[model samples]
Target: MKYTFSILAVILSSTKILIAQTDSLPSNSIVLQPVEIKQYFNKQSILELTNSAHTLSSSTINSQSPTSLTSALNTVAGIRMEERSPGSYRLSMRGSLIRSPFGIRNTKVYIDEIPFTDAGGNTYLNLLDPQSLESIQILKGPDGSLFGANSGGVIRISPQGFDSANDEISLQVLGGSFGLFQQNLGINKKVNDRYQFAFNQSYLNSDGYRENAAFERKSFQTAHQFNYNPKGQLKLFAFYTDLGYQTPGGLTLAQYEENPKSARPAAGPNPSAVEQKAAIYNKTFFSGLGHDYQISSKLSHYIGVFGSYTDFENPFITNYEFRTEKNLGLRTFLSYQNNDLSLPFQFQFGMEGIKGWNKINNYDNNKGVMGNPQANDLLANQQMNLFSRTQLDITKNWVLEGSLGLNKNSIRYETLYPLESQSEGNIKFDNVWMPRLATSYQINNLMALRASISKGYSTPTLAEVRSSDNTINTDLLAEDGINYEIGYKLQGRNKNWLVDLAVYQFEMENGIVRRLNESGVEYYSNAGEMNQKGVELSYWSSWNINTKFLNSIQFNAAITYNHYRFGQYSNANNDFSNNKITSVPDWTMSNSLYLILAKQFQLNITHNHTSSIPLDDANTVFAPKYDLIQARLNWSNSIEKLRTKYTLFVGIDNLLNQKYSLGNDINAFGGRFFNAASLRNAYAGAIISL
Candidate 1:
């Protein structure tokens, strides 16, 4: 395997030199660089965008493998991972409010220009194979002129693909604290100058830190690219993922204080009181094709088309009630670039459509007594959106970008029980439009200033608008919002240091809030206007020193401050003037440091802190602030003769074993608390590349 890779590498290098010589331009003349075929693992250009964006390189991602993507991203500043169970994770930025625990994340997640989040705009990070990823780009703010829908922001993941000149294979096995285990294999091959293929597969399992918090997942990804000529390129890629997990139901404050390790049993005398022994299963598959065409020396065009489907099921502790959801979607985009314009300009347009079906069923003998209480109501929905954006270089050092989008949603509810009202069984939401604009000015070679203002909206979901019981009205309007932001970026000292600062304010009209009706069944309703304002700061620096034993030291830190309030509320039954919004923290911060030592070794340390937050609208329960720390050591070596390399890494998370709750929420069984802001965890892993 190693010899083959070496041979392929040699051939590719030689071919590249020959092509360069053949395409060489005249001496003293400016020459245009030839375009190379796109690869899944290529580094994304973070600095090319005028919007605030951050890129996590492959070097950093590789060091944190065999860990959840959520865990890895939590290290970033202004980013938070809110998780209720192994299968459910939410990525929040700048103190954004999280609406759900499952698949349709309010924040958009993407992979190589493809949307990974479901139709509802939610994403499941656990399902993604971290080993196959090359880099992660996080775009903050509503500058969706290039990307479409749910563009409050975007989390873009890039994968590793075949190198036309190289044949390579790699393997990895990892084990850690809490009975955790993982294995992965990858291969890349160049069939010829015109074709290349890559394959990757991985499996992971873990018995979580908290009792009954266990999970297992498997994933497969493949890519193939065809180069027809120098001016045109086409690539096809597909991915499939399977996930299963059990959740340790969050404990009440009393239960946590009594015995943090004691978990509710899966099967007990009272199913409602026991920990949830749930079976969660999901399968996602998607394929995409893209083409790039150079129309002329001054003009270029590109187009992409994709189709995808997702199916998921969750069975609760009662083993009688279960929920299943299926999604199918199609997306297409076209873009044109022109360098001949007065200033460089790009225009893009796209269309997206999705259909979703969801059902709740009863399998046990228990009737309305337990499980499938809402079995009578099933939902089918469809949504369509059209979007467009334009970007122009307004001046030598200033750029302007703008985007517009329109969306329409329709839903149909089927009722099995006659007692359920027809009004709650059929619903249609109004179409909404969003527009955003942003501008950036380069103050100098090392500093830039940026500002953006955008409008965003969240439509009501079937479950949010309709209920099994007819007590609540489903005619409430959709939630609408507007966001404004201003920020700056600085890179100094030969690019060894980088800093990003941003402040934002958001206002929501008719925001959706879950309310308990007279009969005690919780239902969703439009709440009064609300506002959230926050600031974020991130900094990173690397110092190289010539010393006897030390090579370099790197430090990074991120901090956020949020203020939330109700802008308007009028309830005839009660005075809610002093009510506090639920689940939002006032302050959050994270920091990390790395030291390069002698030999092939390195050390890392990290810390995170979050302020107290409310549990419910009434503000009766409060979760206090907490701190967590982690440490890691890594070593690597290469075998030149065999053209292979190996790396070994050991890590300890929550070195202090701090007992803290990162998130909590009201639940059907009881108000639940999420545990382990930092878990005392250890892991060791090795990667072998041939």
Candidate 2:
């Protein structure tokens, strides 16, 4: 693998001079206008921000025909996404994956200003397909000052909207190894200059490489925009998704070596995942309406209202569970900008309120079938936050920003079936406040430096407080922390080279963790304090050649290093202080190269490496390190006679065929820690538009 990368690098560097004779800058170069990042309320350019943020554009997202965000986001530094199965996902941002076994926990997610995360702070990101989004912006590190109850930053997704002048329909089909298949249909149109709409529908199915890991999903999304007045507009969005996937339980070291494809075997009389038909079925629907009112040249107000419903069923090895959830939210903000003053400034103030209700039930599983009831409960959760942020241009070369947020969270549970040792009641955490201060100095046109200090807070989710063990832990408390960071950014004259680097440290208190009992039932507890230090770096460069066969070559590389340890922790008379954090690798690196030919054909190669990861809180067990390589080739053309465009693509994954674990079950009972990734796989697809 090293030899291959060396050769590719040599080839790319040699081409710089070879094509100089025939190469010339293009006659027409389309430049992208600087767009606002809504996370900051459209106050300033994302590139000029004092914090670390990354944006993935539409072309970059569609480059690989991704089925999951795991593929695209894996290249980003400080961001890690793992898919245990086709429809199951776990995300970690500047945090370890120990607390997020199934869904996104610490982070917050948004879709066009509508909260994708419910009031309970659980995000169902797997419901939306990759094709439904136009772009994604990620803010790394603690950002609770504006986004409430989060320690791992934020993600804002922009859905594809209608384009009046480019009305068209598109269809896509793709299939690959392990019975993988996918189909997507999308349409956009305009009724007039005042109204436009876009819609997308997709279906996907996969017979995974591991036993009992089949997956299926059907999703639909619609977005509409209405220009009611010259300075005002109304936006509406609705989406529905039905997802089902089987789970292949983790494997022990001995089991992994014997048969990586095998699911977890039965432990004595306990049934395995395969024997119990362990799976998850989720049907969800959400709708949102937003209005932007331009009150004056420098003042505007925006309001959004959203509602969602989810019906979930999970049949695990221990028991079968069912959940019915409903969520409603309202958000509004006002922005005032004064660019006419000597010291230009922007101020934004906002408030958000969310309420969620859930009915949870557990039953015995009789050979993949629901049996007698075991437990029944009802939970209600609520959160409200008020925030304000201001940015001031202190000077032509310096900028200052500050923000503050006040948050409140509460949860109530009622047990319908009370058996032995049962407790039911309401619990509320004390009101919390988060604040942030940052400054940026523009050294020159091509370079800048920034420093920031921020406070972080995260409330335990309902699922963690009230776990699958059919018990509610009212003792769990919210976690709080502080983060300090400094960063540098640089760009070349022609914008062909770019670099971003950041280093930071964080101190956290009352961190929450999950533990398995002798019966293998999971429960949550405060694991004490923690300390973390990390660094992130990214670089990109591109060379353009006007040769007939070759047009451009681009390279991208990113690396992340972390040192996380327990500051003070002891459990069951066991001294675990100063131990490494579980499920967090010490280092991760990613590199990619792209070759473009005559604006018609392109080839991309990517490599990723992860160091060993601790599997248990004791640091006695670890998962081995691994490397991965993938490549893709695409060809596109426009047929003038038919007035249509078409594209064909082929790709290969895990070229090295390394037997590794893509996702691990931390602190798993019975030594069930590893979930093997797929072997070498190949896929092909095509797209047509009219």
Candidate 3:
């Protein structure tokens, strides 16, 4: 494997050198701008404190009209978006799989320091409107010590704010293939020299290309800021999101072979019922307050308090059995920061708390199965965390940083039939501490090298720790792991070319696995040890050429190769080794090219490829590899008198309409179901700005 990577690197390097020779231009050409690691308050507050942080600015976020946040983020390196339905998606980073679509995600997600995950830890990316975002920062690895338990990684999404210098209004309307339509409106006003406010609203609907897949959503946001004085400022913000959607269950291998686009499931001796009816309703409210004070020229203080409340209900059926889950959660964060030191040091200390409650009810046909006059089952959990980090400048060209955090969690479970005399339903977890360290050295103006090592821990969610029944045991253990990474970033002197490369290995102990007993009840267990190693490479280039009226061209490509294997697995009767991990692909790659034409017109083409992955531990079933391509065109102009601008955009996904599968269901009635990727889809839209 090492040799293979080395050879590929040589080939890529050679290709770049050749391209550079052919594209050479005089030194008088467009001068390259120098890149700086700025300490903008918001950006510095997180980047300087974390070992692995990547930021996406608003300009990059709006470069494409993505239907969901996941779609927009998919453009980044080392990030993959997995879709379960039209509006349901999961994000995987650094080879960590987000196991459940409706439960807690392995990766943590936050919007302005407020937890976005529900009671069970599941996050729905579709709830966020990409149009209202100003920036997104992804903090990778086990820095959860500062955030809380389940630190696998953190995704921080920041929304657009008010501007005191302008009064602005904007509107957008869109219509596309598959009965898709979207509308958005926003306004920003500066009431006076000291006060400003911004408000936005959006609605989206789609009759998906696949059967039984459709969705509708609405969102609203408001923000206010006050500049009390040069040394003091205050800001307040709130947002509400509501979503409704239908779940289109997976298809079987035989069904996929017969007709890829068909939504019907295969028949059985007992004829498993096709679950065509599934519904989800969710509502979320979020608010926060922030204040900043400049104690002196070299010293400053900043504080923020934020909270969110979310409620969700999902109902679905399989094999005539109906199941419903109701979840609610509350989360809050309080943080303080100080940046004052001779060596340019910044420190942040914060605490976070979360409370969640989940109830699951089951029914056979119309009859209550167990646990109640209500079939009520409840699980409650509380988590608290404290973390701090600081960076020290060791020299003009080198920097060192370290971080520490602590987490405590408690859980309790209850059932309506207390008389059943079940074992202890309450579990208290001990506080866990995590730490990280890293260093970066600048080799020159255009190159840098960095290395990082961190310890991370992930606590089991309430659903994983205390489910409704023993059929699916919830007593799974938490995961503890260590990550080691080293990487380099390089850019050409002209700033028209760039390359980033990284390699990492992670070792996890006491990983959780699910097993079925003789009673046909699925139980959780601390199965075995595992290791994951991968390499990622990315390249980007932009250049201007005088050919066929084309002003410039931009291109980007990235690929990640992962290898994972289990070290041990022991069942009651036997032990196994060298089992390949499930649902993790060995190879994934994506590339895009953009052509900038005259008159604010442009065209973009993109392609993605993923290798086959084992669906089960036995490696008997596999999801085949496939390739996809998409194209887009955009044009913009202004209404001169009104000082307003308009943009018209169109896109075609899966231009070839190739039949492929993007994900599969491992927990179908018989564990034999899959979801086929979309085919030949199109979108068109218009944006009006003032």
Off by over 4 Å in 3: 1-52, 101-104, 118-120, 162-167, 190-195, 264-276, 298-302, 318-344, 359-374, 417-425, 466-474, 514-524, 546-548, 571-576, 667-669
Error of 1 at 214 (Å): 1.7
Q: Which ten residues in a row have the lowest lDDT in candidate 1?
A: 28-37
Model 2 pairs whose backbones collide: none
Q: TM-score of every model?
A: 0.85, 0.95, 0.86
lDDT of 3 by residue, 1-690 (tens): 443465357547644653563464323222221233222233432112324455666545555545665544666666777766677765677644424423335577776645665445556677778777767777666666566655357787767664335487889788887789999887878888888887889999988766767888899988888889988878777888998776666677877777665554534432222242555667877777777677666455666666566666554432112223343333333323444445666555666666666554443322111222324456677777777776667765676777788877776777653336333376666688878788777777777787888776777765566432422244466777888888787776656666667788888777665444343223456766878787777666666664767767666677788887777866666554566666677887767677777777878787777778777656677888777787878898998998988889898888888777665654343554577767788888888889
Ranking by TM-score: 2, 3, 1
The candidate with the higher TM-score, 1 or 2, is 2
* Model 3: per-residue Cα lDDT at residue 543: 69
Per-residue C-alpha lDDT of model 2 across residues 1-690, encoded as one tens digit per residue: 453355346545643543343433332221122234454787455347798887776656666536777877887889888887777899999987878777887898988888889988889998998987878888888888888889889998888773233487889899999999999998877778888888999999999999999999999999998988888989898999999999998999999999999988899768988999999999999999999999999999999999999999999988899999999999899999988999999999999889999999999988789989889888999999899999999998898999999989999888887566455678899898899999988888778899999988899998898897888788999888999999998766555556788999989888888799889888888898988899988766666765789777766777888899998898898888999988899888887777787778888888888889999999999999888898888888888899888889998889899889988888999899989889999889988998
State the C-alpha lDDT per candidate: 0.63, 0.84, 0.64
At residue 379, what lDDT does model 2 achieve? 93
